[model samples]
Target: MTAETQAAPVVSYGRLVPVVVHFDDLDALGLLHNARYPVMVERAWTALWHERGFGFDGDWEAAGDFCNAVKELRIGYEAPVNRPGAYAVHLWLERLGNTGLTYGFRFCSADGAMTYAHGTRVLVRLDAATLRPTPWSEPFRAVGRELLRRAS
Candidate 1:
């Protein structure tokens, strides 16, 4: 992809989802701390699940289905988000494997001048009971594949 075409934080033909910020996410500097990046990712993952109609409540441990492990996480920060307001987060699927998924994220500032952060994450699916790596079920594979098709 050319730099011009790949510039967006979330570049998918599908809808660009938004994730609002929380007051408690701030650090002493008033901007969101670096540690909160992963937390936002988890939320984005959950939001994606809901958007796809795959029900995953906060009760993953009790439901016997979950994103059990993260294989990789990388982020780059370009600006500080210290203001108190809702921010937009974009997510897209790069690779959807049988037992795992890779995601790309772009965090846009409220003012939309700079991209505060961008990242890619790989996660492994696991059996809720065994807590071990396992291939995705048919429904999951299908849903994930459909989602990836919308990627720009």
Candidate 2:
């Protein structure tokens, strides 16, 4: 297959979480601050988690699936978000391992025709008490499988 075909699958899968770029998030140049990209993506992920009934609401044990730590993050900017408006962050499971998973995301226009930034984040599940890597719970893996991309 061609490179274009291979790269097109991500956009076809996963979910789109809405994001609003407020004026406060802009830099002096009137563009969304470079640092805000990850923050926005994080918020999107949090919202998704919440919608899926996973959150830290004083019950650590119940929220263990949301306790993963970022092992890696990579973002590539393709265009600048020049105005504060409605956009979207597309998220999909890239790789789901025993103790960790990698998510692929794109910060783009609401329709996803214009991509401002794209990246992947690697998160390692942790043992709440020991703070060490631990296998993902079955419930967590089940939810993850819904977002997991199928082989092209």
Local accuracy by lDDT, each model: 0.68, 0.86
- Candidate 1: segments with Cα more than 4 A from true spot: 1-11, 57-67, 110-113, 149-152
Worst 10 residues of 2 by lDDT: 1-10
Itemize residue pairs with steric clashes in candidate 2.
Answer: none
Question: lDDT by residue for model 1 over 30-76, one digit each (tens)?
Answer: 98989887787677667767666666667756443364688899999
- Give me candidate 1's TM-score against the actual structure: 0.75
Error of 2 at 19 (Å): 0.7
Best by TM-score: 2
